[model samples]
Each structure stands twice: as C-alpha cells, then as structure tokens.
Target: IQLRAMIRWGLETVHRSLAPWCSVDSIARHLVEQTESLLLQLSDVRPLAPNKSALNHLLATAGWLTPPLVDGLQALGWLIDERGLAGTAATDGLAWCLPMHELFERWVEHLVRLWAYPFGGHVRSGRTFETLVPIRWSSAAPKSLKSLVPDVVVELGSQTWVFDAKYKNHFEELDDQAWFELAEEIQSEHRHDMHQALAYAATCPASQIITVLVYPMRLPVWERLTARGRSVTVAEVLGGDRSVQVALAGVPIQLSHPEQTNQIVAAWNPLFSVGQ
Candidate 1:
C-alpha cells in the first residue's frame, strides 16, 4: 500500500507538472498507457490486500491523493468510458502526438523515480540530474544510424555517466558481430556523442562513460562483456525486487528496472573510465 501510494504520488506530481504544456487528455492517455504497462508487469506479483480503511479514505477524497495517481485513475476511467463510447468521435483517435516540453520533462522525472531510482539509498540526498539541460550531440553522418538517448545522466565526482533506458525483459549476450554492428551504427550517426561526453569530462572528465540500460527482470542472469577495450555490464532488475542498486565507474546507478539499465550503463561507463 505504501509503495502504491508512493508510485501514485510520483505519477501525480508528473501529471501536474506537465499539465501546463500538454492537454489533460493527452497526459491522461500517456499515464494510462504507462499505468497499464505497470499493472500488467505487476499482475504476477501478488498485490497486498487493499486496506479497507485506506480504500475508504481514497474513495472519500480521491482528489486529495497525488495528482499522477489520480490522473492515472482518471485515465483508466476514461479508457473504460471510451470503450463504452466506441464508434463515437468522443474517443480520441490514435495519433502520434509530439509530447510538449513540459510533458517530456515530467515524463523524464516520473521515469527516474518510478523506473530509475526505486531504492531509497541509491541516490544520495534524493537528487537526480535536471532533465531540461541543453545537451546536444554532434549530427551523425549516416542518417540510417539511430542515436541512443540515455534515460538519466549522472555526474559523480569528476565523471559524467549516461544512463539509457531499455524496458526489455532481460539482457542477452551480444556476439562480437552484434557489438561491432551496434558500435558502428552509433559511431556513424552521433560520432560526437561519446567524444562530447569525453570532452565534458574535461570539466568533470569522467573516469568512465556509463550507459545504464533499463530492462525488465524475469529473464536471465545479467551478463558482462568486455570488447574493444570497453566494458559492458548487464544487470537484472527483477520484477519482484524494488530496491536494486549497481555501480558504474564507482557511481551508483539505481533503477526500478535494473536489468536493462545495468546493461546500458555498463556499456558506456568504460569508454571514459578506462584510460582516465
């Protein structure tokens, strides 16, 4: 119940923060999608029986509860309503809408709290790097290459770590060809992403370049790979365990979805740290 409340609070905060830039409808829809995903993931984990008193309290003053969870419930209710109103224009059609800056920012925050930092002690002082910073990577030459965007970027001591979010089931060992292909693709598009991070390391010249990939637990044991003199550590974020923390280049990277995050962070951490 406490965990649910905390999750609800985090979501509501995100919704409120994003409401200024995006419509309540759009935000509600996004929240609903995320909530459904979360619920589906948790379906296997037995939910603690709802406390009757708490249920009554929630029902009486649903408004008083945090906005994200309230918005989530509202979104769920809206989905139910939409199903009833199917075939009517009242239901918003599926569209790939560009998320507003505020919405994106809030989403990032929610992700950090709900997916990145689930363990209490992983983040010291409960601080996370701001999401609105104007960090840009050099344009990639090969247009076909996909530039990776890490979920969280952490600066620890003199190093900056890029943590990418991968919401996959688990980490699989990549063969040499696979790693080479991925590295080749990354180098082709955003040639400077790694270099820029290394340059940024001048100020905090990271001892390591970390990429934290977020993956769902319940697959296999996390694997660690070292290739081209770079190290990649794959860690698992079990669905049942909420508090999981791993270190990349000495910086603590915590994730609610540890399996994926660990792989990402591990892959990038060594790039900057090896020779430093």
Candidate 2:
C-alpha cells in the first residue's frame, strides 16, 4: 500500500512540475509511451550479449538514468534474462530501482517518525545524525565526502562504522570450494572497508572503529571480524521486507521500510546516549 502510494505521489509530483507546459494526462501519456519504448528496446537485447548500438540507443533514451540506477537496472536485466522471474530471488532482484528505492526508504522513515517511538527523543535527519552526517577524511582532499555522493566511507559517532551497500542476489548455500572462495573475497573487501573507516576514525580519537557488511538478509550468518583491535560486523537485511536483521558497529543500518528503520533508530538511541 505504501509503495503504491509513493509511486503515485512520485508520478503526480512529476506531472505537477510539468503541468504549466502540458496537461497532466498528456504528460503521463508521454511518460508511459517513453517507458514502453525503452522497455521494448531493452527487451530486444540481452545484456550478456549486448550490442554496442543497442546499448547506446537504450542509454540515449534513458537520459535521466543515474549511475546507481543504471547499475540496478542492468543487475535486474541480468537476473531476469538468466533466471526465470518466478521466485523469491526474482522478486528481491527486481526491487533495485536506485533513487526510487531510496525515496521509498525515506518515506518509510517519515511514517516511522509520525507513528513510532522516537529513536533518541529526537529523530535525526539530514546532517544532524551521525550516520547521515558526512566527514572529510583528508583535510586536503579535493572534495568533502558526501553520503549521497556514494563511495565507501566510515560513519563516526560513539563507534566508528565502515559501511557499504551491496545490491546483489543472496546465496542460500555453497559447497566447500565456493565457501572458501566466498570467504576470501568477503574478507578482502571487509579489510578494505575497515582500513578506510579506520583512516576516518583516526581524526576522531574518542570513537571506536568498527566495520559492518550489509547484504540482503537471505544470506546466512552475520559474523564478526577483528584485526588489530578494530572490529567488523556483518549483517543481513531482508531485501523484501527491508527489515534489519543485525546491527553492528562501524556500519550504517540501511532498512527496507522506514517504519521498521525508525524502530531500529529508537533502539540505537540509548547506545548513542550512553556512548556520548
């Protein structure tokens, strides 16, 4: 229900902005036409065997496609073309529309603020909250790192958290070789995340540096990693429900629904208060 309402609101908002130049119905019709055309073009080409010309055409049509959105759409297209779209995995894979997903997430947060208990008697938004807040690691770095900008960064508060968002299908099980390879890959990535977060925390002495791995909840096991006194926590969040399964130091909690996230924020408030 909330998702549908958000989609409608997004369409309405777009229509309103363009209303002065065109009628709402006309604007909507044009959007539909464009989307259908794009889908048709996309349908003809398999991403694995994508022809350069076809990719160019699709790209030209999707002018508003941001990097993350492009990544998401390509990921979805791959999943659909390879795996028949008829299961929990497919449903979860289709839920990656980038900024649209982000909008829905924020909406959930808004609903939580209105209906749920406050995280710390004050719901943090914008740059006020530790996780949402941005920090500059190198004083001389060309630009201040922004969360919206999208790159690996450690969020510092009472504890230092290294955070990254993985938008991929979850694994149910793996054989021994696959398990070893997977573990090695994750360990390397986790170490890199830790180094970056630790670098950020060096500037802020009071904070304890921690690392977190955030992946779709379908993946099993949330393990803890410790190297040289730094801690890394791995958590699995449900892709469909967006419910957070684990919370760890050195990681920002990314939830599927805002209401559920608000509950998480409320839970974290006490820890924050005591740590502060």
Candidate 3:
C-alpha cells in the first residue's frame, strides 16, 4: 500500500516537472512514461497520511530514488510490529531508509568489483553458499539446505578470497589497551564475525583462502591474524588515501583516493609481473 502511494507520488512529481520542459530529453520522457505505466498498475493501493508526505518529499529530490525506495520499503516491512506500527517510526526515520549494514555491504561490493579488474580477477556476487553446522534433516531434506552466502567472492587463478563487509565499529579507541579491554558484547560480536569469515574460508576448496573482514572506520588500519594456517584479516576502509602502500597480506589493494588512478596502476605493476 505504502509502496503504491510512493510510486504514484513520484509519477505525479515527474509529470509536473516534465510538463514545463518544452524540449524534453529522451531520459526524461522515458522516466515519465515508465512512471505513468507503474502508477496504473498500482491504482488499487491506498495511501497512508503523514508517511505519504514524507515519502513524497524523499521522492521529489534530484537524484535517482529507485534504490532508496526499495531499501525504505524493506525497512518498513521488517519494522512493523504486531500493532502494525513501525517501532522506531515515531522516534527516527530509519524505518524509511536502508539498513546501515546492507548499505555498507553493497558499497563495499561495488568497490571490490571495480578493484578486481586490476587483479585480473572477477568478483562473483553471492555465487557460493556454505551449509550450516548441525545441519537439520527432514524427510524432504533434499529440498532444503541451510546455507550461508558471503557478500562477495573474488577469484584469481586458483586463489579464492572471500570478502565480508561488516558495518561495525569494533574498536573503542585506537590503542592495544582498548582492544584488550573491549566490552563483552562487542567482543562477542567480533568473535561471531571472525567465525563467519572462517566458515566462509573453510568452504573454499582453494589452497590459499584469504578471508577479509572489511570494516568502516575513520582511519585506515590493517590487522592480520592466522588461525589453523588460515589468514584472517580486519581491514579498515579509511576516509582518504593517506598512503600509497596499501597492501593486504602482501597483496596490494587500493583504498579510496582522489588522485589514485595512476598510483593504483603503478601499485599493481608488481602484481602484474607476478601473475605472468
């Protein structure tokens, strides 16, 4: 119902904008036509007040809102309680936006896909799934298998690296003491992320499995831990590229930077020779 109203509002706003433009571009015409078609399909759905206004304002913005609208719908769906009201709708607007973790995961996946080209590899999106531990069995077990899928898997030759982007602030302060004195809940969450990454690594048949936990922080930091001969890492994607020597387990990966194209290519120069 809410989705239909949002789309209807969008269609109306676009129609209004396109009406004044005497020479409409191909893109604007297409958008207007598509929205009209969609509005017809959603004629039966009714709109809710207050929420509709908020959604309309969001959709009236300049940039594309398809992805954000989808995200908001998902948020609204999950947040509705037994009483049919979003638990946090009155308190915050999160119910009308994408979950932070999902947003981060998608952003990381996008960056990894772009970066994979330099490594002569392709980033496969959720192509691999690992069966859950203590696998549940039923008479129709063949039809059902509990599985876990990593966010992105980068394959280069025989090497398979699983990248899981976790949008968590796992550290309290930038000090060894802070890490050692982490709160119990935070420690538990970190341990869970590590276990999940290890699980993904174990599912890979490749001899060299690199499991990296990509986290967002204000500073660029890197940590490597090895358990049972497997490499587990926590990599912080920083705000800006402060240095050019960004290497992960001796394999260089570029971070966010404005003037990084030539430098990134130069950094990959060594890897190119090794690949040959």
Q: Total backbone clashes of model 2?
A: 9
Backbone Cα, N, C clashes tallied per candidate: 27, 9, 0
Best by lDDT: 3
**Worst 10-residue stretch by lDDT in candidate 1?**
118-127
**Per-residue lDDT of candidate 2, residues 150-219 (tens digit):** 2233333444333333332222222123546676665566456445543443443333432233333221
| Tens-digit per-residue lDDT, 53-172, candidate 1 | 554466567666676655544443333334211212245523345544333334333444333332221221112443223444567643542332334565545434444333322233
Candidate lDDT scores, in order, read 0.38, 0.37, 0.51
Tell me the spans in candidate 1 whose CA falls farther than 4 Å from its real position: 1-96, 99-151, 155-160, 164-187, 190-192, 205-276
Better of 2 and 3 by lDDT: 3
Using Cα atoms with residue i matched to residue i, what is each candidate's TM-score against the true structure?
A: 0.29, 0.30, 0.44
User: TM-score: which is higher, 1 or 3?
Assistant: 3
* Runs of candidate 3 exceeding 4 Å displacement: 1-96, 127-145, 171-178, 219-276
**Candidate 1 overall lDDT versus native:** 0.38
lDDT of 3 by residue, 1-276 (tens): 665665455445446555443232344556667757876887887533226445446556626657866565434443332112223224443434778778677656655665576567767776333322334477665755466688887777766667777777653122334656877888888788777877776666655556666665442332122212112223432343221111122111233442333332233232223323
